[model samples]
Target: MGKSIFISLPVTDLKVSVAFYEALGFRNNPRFTDETAACMVWSEAISFMLLTHDKWRSFTTRPIPPSTSSEVMLALSCDSREAVDAMSQAAAAHGGTVDINPVEDHGFMYTRDLADPDGHDLAAMWMDVSPMPARS
Candidate 1:
């Protein structure tokens, strides 16, 4: 069997967070969703479990960071440069903040970073590895 990753995040508002994730192309898996949490599917191997504050605390007593602070950054691969840009636009249109860091452009890859409404850092990127230089 293949392994998969399930990222758990604490959100202030369940519905809004779900919508934001959806805009970025994640689909809600109702079988794993409820009033307190939602399983947002990005692909066959990737999924995010967005949990309400109370629901989050049930699993850990660790303090939830304030909206202005970030502890980690998540990166997603896009099919093309246009897909990366589209995700940036979608993020801005939603409650998310787009381009938290300046855009990065290398000949083989392009990236744009954004932050969710709750301040989770997310990076959308597209890369062509064919031209990448091999390690010495």
Candidate 2:
């Protein structure tokens, strides 16, 4: 079996966070979802566990970062630049912030950043590997 990663994020509201993630193309796996957490599945190997503040504290002694600060930025790869843009729009419409960063276009790659309601940072990116310049 291939390895998998479970990214756990501290969310203030489980339902809203689940909806926010769903708008960004993640599906909830009911088997691991409840009032305190939602298992948002991006793919077979990538899943995010959106946990409530109390639940999150149980796993770590570190204080939760304020909404204005970011501890990490999670990036998801899209099949096309249009897909990245679509996700950015969806994020905004679903109560997330899409103005965290400017849309970056570098010929072979494009990307944009978004912030969830709880201010968890996320990025959507698309790359055209066929157009990548060869390394020296």
Best by lDDT: 1
For model 1, the superposed segments whose C-alpha errors exceed 4 Å read 133-136
How do the residues 4-40 of candidate 1 rate in per-residue lDDT, one tens digit apiece? Answer: 9999999999999999999999999999999999999
lDDT of 1 at 25: 97
lDDT of 1 at 16: 94
lDDT of 2 by residue, 37-136 (tens): 8999999999999999999999998999999998899999999989999999999998899969887899899999999999999999998898667999
List the global CA lDDT of all models: 0.95, 0.93
**Global fold similarity of model 2 (TM-score):** 0.94
* Candidate 2: residue 130 lDDT (0-100): 88
RMSD of each: 1.3, 1.5
Model 2, total clashes: 0
Instruction: TM-score each candidate.
Output: 0.96, 0.94
